[model samples]
Target: MNSSDAVDIATDALVVIAKISAPFLLVVLAIGLIVGLMQSVTQLQEPTLSFVPKLIGAAVVIALAGPWMLDELVGFAHELYQRTPQLLEG
Candidate 1:
């Protein structure tokens, strides 16, 4: 309703998004780094060698953390819905 309210909502949404995505992002980053190190050591320089592991790492993170991510998203949505009336009244 107000600029401050809108900003708060936007910030909360961004935080939810970051919380949901962080695990996958961190896992992929770590996997990529390790793969890069291995590639350098062996001088393989294969693209897929780097990509596949990162992809798999991301997928594994998603699979492991999917329920928690869903809970965070659902909680955020529920909070927003609960605030809708107050927001509208303003």
Candidate 2:
């Protein structure tokens, strides 16, 4: 309802987002680096090489971590719901 409340919600949202995304993002980054180096060494410039591997890597990671991700998201949502009254009162 106030600037402080807005700021609080935004910061919480960002923090949760970072937590949820950091692991998968790190995996993708590492895979991308490895793929890039492989491409550089092999001198095989296939346009689809990067896209397929990265897509598969992300899909696997998301599939493996989906439950944990859901749990964290649900927890964050619950916390936000619980805080709604306090935010509104302010």
C-alpha TM-score for every candidate? 0.95, 0.89
Q: Which stretches of candidate 1 lie over 4 Å from their true place?
A: none
lDDT of 2: 0.88
Candidate 2 per-residue C-alpha lDDT over 1-90 given as tens digits, one digit per residue, 9 for 90 to 100: 899888988998898899889878988898889998999999988877888888898899899988898998899899989998988787
Worst 10 residues of 1 by lDDT: 47-56
Clash pairs, candidate 2, are: none
Model 2 weakest 10-residue run by lDDT: 44-53
Model 1, 1-90: lDDT tens per residue?
Answer: 899999999999999999988898889889988989988999999888877787788788878898999999999999999999999999
Angstrom error at residue 89, model 1: 0.3
Which runs of model 2 end up more than 4 angstroms from their true locations? none
